[model samples]
Target chain A: MMKRIGTYLLQSKYAISVTVLIFVVLGASLATSSFLTGDNLITVLRQTSVLFILSSGLTAVVLTGGIDLSINNSAALVGCIVAQLLLLGVSIPVVILAGILVGVVIGIFNGLLVGILKLPPFVATYGTNMVVLGISTIVMQGKVIYDLPRNFTPIGVGYVGILPIPVIIAIVLTGVLYFVLQKTTLGRNIYMLGSNAYAAKYSASRSVLDTVVAYVICGVTAAIGGIVLTARLNAADANMGNSYGLQIVAAVVMGGTSLLGGEGGIFGTVIGALVLTIIMNVINVIGVSSYLQSMAVGIVIILMVWLDIFTRSKREKLSRV
Target chain B: MTTKSLGKRIGSLPPAVWMIAVMLVFYGANTKNYFTASNFISILIQAAPLFVVACGQTIIVLMQGTDLSLGASLNMMTVVWVVLMQKSLPLSVALPLAMGTSVLAGYLNGLIVAKMKLPPFIATLGMQNILNSVALVASNGSSVYHEHAIYKIIAKSSFLGVPYILWITIGCFFLTMVLLKFTRFGARVISMGGNPESLKVAGYSPDLATIQAFTYTGFMTAVAGFLLACRVESGNPIVGNGFEFNSVAAVLLGGTSMREGRGGVGGTVFGVLLIQILKNGLVMMNVSSIYQTAIIGIVVLFAIMLDAYIKRRQEE
Candidate 1:
């Protein structure tokens, strides 16, 4: 029974991340007086909520054997547009829809480049990211748009039964995505397509536009995350999304989602997001200079990836034996 | 091949050349001082650092690998050079110390990609961030100003009516060309990208080529980074921000096959020229930096799409 359990753990992509998250929480709670506090934990959860939402869409893209380096910028652009509309006295509902519509358009543009046109995901998205950043700069005149509407506050910070709205939104989004990926035809198609593109093309169960659909979903999710982030900050700026570029990619990667695609899922991403937040928090509690945070994050990603690699090779050896 | 087919092939070269041609004409006609020799010199000098890095990046891409960390490593070298000088170190001591770190980074990147059995994309990216952090930590996360008269003199010196930096860039270009065109290691590098299996059949490990390519990139990035630091006379943490992307874009525009490794570093010179010229022209035309980058991004994207479409048609 122990051997079977061990084998299962070795085979599961998410097992390591979950184990890491739990151990971190246990260690931090024991060592740091501030770590176990309700306020700190809630703050961690809020950060995870925003990160997880962004990473979920990225997970979908990576699953299709592609990446969207522009997702952060797209989210930023959406936030900028939403902020402008809010300032213009537009209703909250319309503002939200408008943000999503902008996301959808960006998604379609990216979809054409990567899917139909067959450009490289990173190159296409990187270029698109630059364009998105430029447009946002022009949209906001490179200034922060503060003073968000009061009604939007509940979405970012207000609580329902002592749980933050962003957290609730994240949980609901994760559950829906988990169901869709596990139970839907589109989800299976994505998996097959990612695993072997040519084989998928010949398979009778294939849809020609599976790649496009994956990107579109990614776009929509990015918009949702952007709206929440804007509400959370109560402002928008051109460079706000710039920092998330590395973090989001790192989170999605840590979540056990392979960059090469066809393996891993939403659940792994949740753990990935939580673990990232805790690591950043630990850096703060330990009083690493705030300026060195970027370096610290870089080290965390390298170590995490190396650990993953080390474990993977060990798993292969055990299977071989 | 006959002259007719040679002319035909030239005519059918990728869309980037045509686009650059149109851009040159339009900007030349519209912008004041766009066609002057002084502007040309300024653009070439501006392209110098990027051109040098792109030459090294050419080999990396030719081997079907990417070094997302080059820019960061370059950034690290700049700050390290300055910090060492600030500590009263002489030129000989400061130069090697700074250059060695990035070379080491390149070596680590090679090991991660070739030996650790990890993908180059993530490994290099992780390394890039680490190097970026190191630069920040070394210089306290801001610009470091130092009075390095040697670099300033080197920057100001003109040999044969051209600045020393331009000479260095030109030297690196020819060096890269000769290395790619004449060396056995170069053959192995190209083969590693074109077909790793064939390399093994020829009794050369593709892994060694990968390592060698990365090390080369490290050395060139150090040279370029330090030169740029001298030109600007300060160690800015983010000075090397866009070189990685710009170098890759230059490589692509040069018509090097990213997948097949079918081109040479010789073409990358023109690609670098195109980019620097475009930026200069836009600056002269009063375009803001942000929008200028956007336009360049769009043009690059369009060229890539057109190239892909043409390649697909050829394959079909």
Candidate 2:
């Protein structure tokens, strides 16, 4: 019975993440009773909502066997642009639309570079990131744009019966993504392309177009994340989204998504984001030095990646046996 | 016949060389005294440390791997060196200790990639974060100043019309060139990049070559960091910020293939010169720093695309 349970655990896609989540939750509860309180738990989920949106997009790109290092930069640029537009008296909806459109255009450009020009994803997205940073700096002139209209606050801070708007958005998006990934032909093509591009080629998949679309989804979601963040803070700066680049990558990797592509689901990413959020919250509650936070995060990322690799190899061996 | 051959040779030269020449002429036309010997010497001085760093970066890139920890390693080395110097440790002890730390950092990176089998990108990225934090913690997030005469002398002293820093930079490049061209390890390094499977079949360890490449990179980064600290006479935690990307950009601009095994230190010299000239030219043209970055980004994208196009055409 124990062996059978072990095999079941190994076969289940969500098993490892669930185990990790349970461990972190229990540990955090032990560290501080405040961690399990409803208010703090909601706060953690609210903070994780923005990262969830960003990671959802990244998961699509990663599922296609490509990465978009520029997602954070794209988000920052869009946020800055949207903030500027709002300050100029543009309506909030129009401003939001403009921001997302900007992200889509950048995504299309990245798609062209990766799909059509055949540039490596790292180099192409890195170049795009630099360009976006430069442009954002020029737009803001290295100053933060604040004093946003209050109407913009609802998407970030508003609550419907004690549930934050951002959390609701994250949940709805995850459900939509789950549906698309499981039930759509394009989604299946993305998985196939990531798993084996050579085989995908002969199977009538429009590989390049699919790759482009995946990046577009990544860009749009990043832009939405940016918009939400701007609303949360009621401000935007050139460097605002810089930290998100590495953080989002870490969360996605921790979520059981393979950097080499062809495997992973959005649900795993959600758990990954939650785990990271809880870790940070615990660190904060425990009064760890801010300087050491980065070190802690880095160590956690390495450990999680090692654990992932170990489990994957074990699972493969078991399957072969 | 000689003239035609010479024209062909010039035409075949990397795009960076022509870009440098064109920028020089443009700067000369736009800025006063841009062509003076003093200004030229200053440009060379600024390029020296960057050239050294790029030389190291070139080797790692030839192996189809990257060392993103370079900038953080530089920052950490500067912080450690400066802090030790401030504590009244003799320069002799402090300098070697700092360099040894860098070597250890490089070895850790190599172990993670070579032994643990992590992708170089993720491994180096994590290392970058760790080293960055170490630098911050060491320096307490503030700049450490060294007002000693030795620091000034090392930065400003000249030997036969060349600065001491310039000499050190050239020496580093020369040593690396020789290592790449005249050593068995060098051959193995190149082969490891070009064909790892074959290297394994031949009974030589690619893992050792990877470790050696990273170790060499660490040494050069330490030397460059030392030179930078000397020039400024201060160690700021952010001193090496953006340098890793800049070095990668310089190496790529030098016509190195990102795929590995197809570039050399020779082209990297011209690449370094090209970037320095562009920076100086933009400043002389009164362009803002932000716009300069945008322009450089555009140029990088264009160069990489053009390289890809050329390779594709050749294949066709």
lDDT of 1: 0.83
Off by over 4 Å in 2: A1-10, A197-205, B1-12
Per-residue lDDT tens digits of candidate 2, residues B163-273? 898889989999999998899778887777788888899998999988888888889998988898888788888888767777877887787777758878899888888
Per-residue accuracy of model 1 over B1-316 as CA lDDT, tens digit each: 9999998898566555766788889998898767788888888888889999999889988887677788898889999999999999998999899999988998888887877766676778778878888998899989997786877665778899989999898889888888888999889988887888998899988778888888888888988987888888888888998688778888878878778978878778877887888888889999877677668777667767777777778778
CAPRI quality band, candidate 1? medium
**TM-score of structure candidate 1:** 0.95
Local distance difference test, each candidate: 0.83, 0.83
Candidate 1 deviant stretches above 4 angstroms: A1-6, A197-208, A303-321, B1-7, B12-14
lDDT, candidate 1, A1-321, per-residue tens:
988877777788888778878897888787688998999999999999998888788888888888888888899999999999999999999999999998888888888888766777887887788788878888887689888989986788889999999999999989988887779988887777777854735553234477777888889888998999999999999877976777887787778777767888998889888988887887789888765666666766777667666766778799899
Q: Which ten residues in a row have the lowest lDDT in candidate 2 chain B?
A: B306-315
| Model 1 steric clash total | 0
Return the lDDT, model 1, position A67: 85
